[model samples]
Target: MSTLELECPGCDQVLELDAGFAGGVCRCSNCGTLMTVPVEAGQTAEVVKQRQRPARPDRPMTPGEAEAAAKADEQVYTTTSGREVRVGKTSIPTAQQKKRLMVRTATAVGFISVLAGVLALAGMGVWMLSQAQREAGERTVIEAFEYSPGANPYDQRLANVLGLPLAERVVVVVDASASSEVWLDEVNAAIGAGLTETSSASEVVLVYTNGDGLHMHPSQPRAVARWRADQLIAFQQGVSTAGEGWLDEAVARGMQWLPRQMVLVVGREPSEGELVALERAFEADAAAKLDVVAVDFDSAALDDLTGTYGGRYVPMTREQLVRWRER
Candidate 1:
C-alpha cells in the first residue's frame, strides 16, 4: 500500500495511513482524541485515473461510477499554503509559464553583466587617477636664473640676495659651441626640477667649458669638487661662440661637470670629446666616484649611450613640468 503521512488540521496530531481512510471520523492515536478529517467529495487518485482511461470495448464503468469519476477529475494538488497546485500528467505546462522562465533567466544575466562592467570601469578609473597623482608629487621647484656671465645677472643677483645656504646649490653648465635661445628654457626647467628642500641634502653647481670643463659650487663638507660657479662662468663668457654651437658644447660640457651627487642638465647627446674626457677622468681617478646624473630636456635625444654606463636620464614634458611644479 502507498502510505501517506498526514496531520489532524485542528489538533496538530500526526497520522500516517492511506488517504482512502479519510472517510469520516478518525480516532487520534494520542490523547485518545477523536477527530474529523475532511475528504473532498468523490475525489481520489483512483477515481481520477479511472476517468482519464478510455472505455474498454469489453468493460466500462457503470453510470454512477462514471459520474463519480467525472467529479474526481476536477481534483487538484492542494499545498500546505492552501493553494491549488497542478501536479499530475494532466497539468501540461502553458506557453505563458515557459515565457516567464525565459524572461527571468535573461534578466539575471543582463543584470550581472551590467554590474561587472560598472565595477571594471570604476576600478580602471581609480588606478589611473592614483598613478597620475603619485607621479605629480615628486619634487618642489626654485629659480636661480643667476648664471649669466656679465652685469651680475638677474639670476646671480637673486642668488646673492637669497644667499641660499651653500648646502643648497644649482649647477648650470656653460657650452662654448652654440647659443641655445630655443633650448635654454628647457634646460632650465630640467635643472629646476632637482631643487628640493626635503630631509635629503642637495648642492647646486654650474659647469662651464670653452676648451677645458669646470664644475663648481661653494662650501662642501666633502673635500671633492670645490669649483666656484662665478669663476667657471667667467671662463665660459670669453669662449668665442664663433667656432662651435653653444648647446652642443654645453651638453658635452655636462659630462665634464662636477658635484658627484648633483644634477647634470643638458640639451643634447654629449659630443665625442666629452665622452673621451669622461672615460679618461674616471679612469685616471679610479676611486673617484664622479657621479653624473644626466637629464635630457630634448625628448628626441634620450637613448642609452653604448648600451652601458646608463646614467640617470630624465625626460621632461612641458605639461609634466607644470604639474611637477604645482606640487
Candidate 2:
C-alpha cells in the first residue's frame, strides 16, 4: 500500500491523501486551511512567493487548547515494532457547560433582589407618611367643672376640684363650728359633684373640736366623711363655743391622726393662740409626710397656717379656688 502527501495552497499547510480523500477537499494538518488535493495530473497550481516566517511554537490557541496540546504532545505510543509515537490534536467544544449557565443565573437573581428591596423601602416610607397625616387630622379635647361652698367656696371647690375622679391620697378636716349647718350644704354640693358613696379611698378625718381651744368630743374617734357627715355636722353644731377659737387646737389635736394625703380644710380660722398651736402641730406633722390644707369660711386665719406648713390655703372665693385647679 502507498500513501500520497498534499500541501494546502491557502495556508501552506501539509495534508495527506487518505483512501477516500482523493479528488475531494482535504484539511491541512498545520493550519486546518481547506485545500483541493490535485488528483488529476497537469493541473495548474496557484502559487505565490512565500516570505520567511517567524518561528512560532505552534498554531494560534487559547490557554485551555494549549494545555490540551501540551498533554497530547506528552503522549507516547508504542508501534507494533516497539517504537514510540507523539500525537497532536486540536481542541473540541466542552461537553459539560452547566457551570457558566449557573453563574449567569445567580447574577441575574441578585440584581432582581436589590431592585425589590429598593421598591419595598420606598413603599413603606409612603405608608408611614400617610398614617401620620391622618392622625394629625383628628381631634383632642379636655373637660372642666366649677365648685362653690358656704364659708370657703374655694375650699369646697378645692375639694370638688381635687376630689373629683380622685386617684391619689386626699384627706379632709372640717371644723364643727356653730355655722356647721350652713357648711354641710357645701359638703353636700361637693358630694353631688363626685364623692364615692362607700369607698374610703380617701381618708376623711373630721375635727369636731370647738372654739376657745376646747376638744368638745374628745372621746369620739375620727370617722370617714361618707358615714359620719351628719354626725360630724351635728357634732359641730351641738358643741357650741363661747367665742372660743379651736383653730390651732384642732390641727394640734388632729396631728396625731394625720396620714399621708392632700388635705381639704373647712370653716374659719381659730383665735391667734389656737392658730399658733395649729401651725406648730402642722410643722411637726409635715415632718412625718402629712399635707395640711385649711379652708376657712368664717375668716382666712387658716391661710397663715396653710402658708406656714406649705399646705394649700384656698380663699373663700369660688373663682380663686376654681382657677387653682385649672393652673
* lDDT, candidates in the order shown: 0.39, 0.43
Q: What are the models' TM-scores?
A: 0.29, 0.35
Q: Compute the lDDT of residue 29 as modeled in candidate 1.
A: 56
Candidate 1 residue runs with Cα over 4 Å from true position: 1-179, 189-201, 209-259, 286-310, 317-327
Q: How far is candidate 2 from the true structure (C-alpha RMSD, Å)?
A: 20.3
> For model 2, what is the alpha-carbon lDDT of residue 217?
31
Query: Candidate 2, 148: how far from true, in Å?
Result: 12
Candidate number of the best lDDT: 2
Tens-digit per-residue lDDT, 126-239, candidate 1: 999988754443221123232221211122222221112122333344343344333434333333322221222233445543343343332222211333435434533443
lDDT of 2 by residue, 1-327 (tens): 123466556655444443222333445555556555454521222222222323445678778765654764333333233333332233221111113457778999999999999999999999999887544432110012232232332233222323332212333444545554444445434443333233232334445443445443324332223444454445445555344335555655556655444344455545667656655765666642333333334445655555655544544533434444343
True-structure RMSD, every candidate? 19.1, 20.3
